[model samples]
Target: MLAAAAAAGAAIWLTTAWLLNTADHAREGTDRAKVRVDAVRTGLAAGAGAGAAVGLLLAFRRQRHAEIATTLSDYDAAERRVTELYNAAAEQLGSDKAPVRLTALYTLERLANNDPSHRQTIVNIICAYLRMPYTPPLDPTREADPEAAQRAAARRYHAVRGNARPAAQPTTTPNPNEERQVRLTAQRILLDHLKFDARVPWNKLDLDLTGATLLTFDLSNCTLSSARLSGATFHGTTDFRGLNLAGEARFDDTIFSGLTLFMEATFAGSANFGRAIFSRQTDFGGASFSMQTSFERATFSNVTNFGGVTFSKSFSFNGATFAGPALFSQMTSSERATFRGSTFSGYTEFNATMFKRDPAHELDETTSGWFDEFGELVFSRAADFSLATFSTEISLDGAIFSGDVSFRSATFSGNADFSKATFKQAVDFADAAVADLSSPPTLPAGWRIEPGEGATGLIVNT
Candidate 1:
């Protein structure tokens, strides 16, 4: 303000002196002096206003920086607190007491529920815990009832036969029953959070349950991103009904020692069950595979059902063995479905099935292009399809069949190419329908096709 006043007074004085005539300016000095005083006051006020504005701007900038610093400090402290809690809970998970372990799992679950950023990490920790070896108590009920005792005895017998028991001895917690419940709690936590209709579903989480021993494990009606159950062992009945897998699902070399159900499951990505063993009844009824699927070298020891299934991409059952009754009736496929070099020991059914393979999918015409076991499509055992439908060219060239083959009342829409196929047992094609008269089926020397049931239907006489 003082500098502004001095500069304003000097400018006003110089202007007044220059504008006045010599005699008149000398007489108007008092008036010029009065004008200079008012100009000094106006400049002082303008300078004071500018200084106030600068002070306010600086004050606001300082406040904003302080706010930002406070926010950052609070965030850092919260992050450290969360890390400390996570570490403490993880340490508690290794406690010897089952109750303590359960508490730790619940604590981690609560933390995950509160903070979504930590959900996948929490899931990984739980999966790692499950991967730790576990052998279920003989009877899951752990009761003194007669039924429980009998099941326990049977399990013991099986154990002696080198059948199961992949779990390692618990070093900290020796009590198997308590540990089983703890593991079950952990599994329950996952299920509750991953349920299809869960209040807060943890979507798009990956599961790595490889080599875990699960008892009556049910993850039905859950949507998962990816799953790895390779080499895992499932005891008791395992249910995966209505499950949805968004990414690749692997069950390679897995063992299902009890009833296994995968009903109505949808796999958007590649699904594999290579070399898996199903010791009891296994049902995949109403399941759909949208991508590549394989059951190569898999063994189904008991009743196996794949009824009402759909495969939109490449599907293979190459070298698979069915020891009991296998039902593949009422199934649909949009791509090549291979059963090359497979063995069926019991009654096999493919009633009202549709096998449609596009010509472009014919990777190898001479030999079926399997993942690792490419060979001619051969049915080494019994195969019965009372009312099935073959939609494309089925090449059975150079195939050798040793068991009974029946295709009664089945419809063939394309070339039923079996030029060099040998049937050692009785082959039946009673009342079958052939749509492609231009490309007749190639049969053996003694076999003859004749008119039968309908105008388009035919029968094979051997």
Candidate 2:
């Protein structure tokens, strides 16, 4: 549009100049000459106006182009500075001094806050730092000898005072306490950015903490997209209370050496804990699983809780070993949930639990053959399923109960198979409801059988 305006203005000016020159050559005294002069003056005035408009338009265009060029230059400079700062901080992370590494971590965090485009990359760097092998310093105060504590304190004092003599050569290993502080700082950086109410939130960031050794890890009320913690070892209390996982959460082969809490967590995708080990008390109370969850071959060495959990998809505890009391009270499974081949070395409770399979719910081919299977499960202590309800077919085909077992008020809406189950101690089925009793549950011959009032199925007592 500007070019067209300029061209039209130039054309008008040139035409007016030609008209003026033609009028200037005519005789001046006659009426025709005067008319010619007046016409010449009018044409000259129009030419001047057109010239002014063209000048203004050109000036405006040049000013706008200059402004745009300045903006581009500024953007280029800002990008270069950001790159330089990022590179410098990254280099500092590789410094041999722990304090320098800590400073670098904070600098990277600030850079991420100021630059949203590189937030995820900065987070990945921090997680990668944490993924590196780290061992927490053992507390000397815990030792039986007082001399250990004194030695640790003296070393710390000397380091702080900078009075210790420098080594002739750089040591390959970092000071335990200094390295621990750096690791903790790195962990804090991640947690700070991941907070939901962060000033600069990094939401849905995928974490790769695989094989990382974390101490006193707490991620309560945080939201994550996905996490890979396979083979990671957690020390001290590891809290994941109220965590919201939007994608797969892998903890395969991970070890929790301290109390692990997952109370009220929501898993929107598959959760895998295959071959994991919990060396202390673990809690998953009131958690919700929206997809397939597996604890296959996992070992729980202390008390474990799964009370009030909701399984919206297939769940398995196959080949798992529970060495302490196991609680599944008030648990609900919307799809097939199995504990096949699991062993309970302590008392097991499934009181008031419900396993209902929705006929409208579709299962994949891999899970279509799954049922509420407890086949080959061994209960070393009392197993309780009092007041439990099963709306789908359930199988305990080859389970062995070393202690007393109870199904006192359980209701089975579908076929209940106990084809080869063994009850070595007293077994109770008082007032239990069964859908099909044609193939009665295998019971020891000496056990007494009684029928409850208005109950169609026979109750067993041993």
Best by TM-score: 2
Residue-level lDDT of model 2, residues 1-462, one tens digit each, is 566456556655676677757777776668657766676667666656776677778889999999999999999999899889878888988888998998899888888888778888888888888888777768822434688768867777777689776334434577767777788888888877787876678787888899999988888888899988999999889999998899999999999999999999999999999999999999999999999999999999999999999999989999999999999999999999888999999999999999988766866677656468999999999999999987777888789999999888887666666657888888777777664454334444443335444434555555
RMSD (Cα, Å) of model 1: 9.1
Indicate the worst ten consecutive residues by lDDT in candidate 2.
439-448
Instruction: Write down the TM-score for model 2.
Output: 0.84
> Which candidate gets the maximum lDDT versus the true structure?
2
Per-model CA lDDT versus the true structure: 0.80, 0.84
Error (Å) of candidate 2 at residue 227 is 0.8
lDDT of 2 at 344: 98
TM-score of 1: 0.80
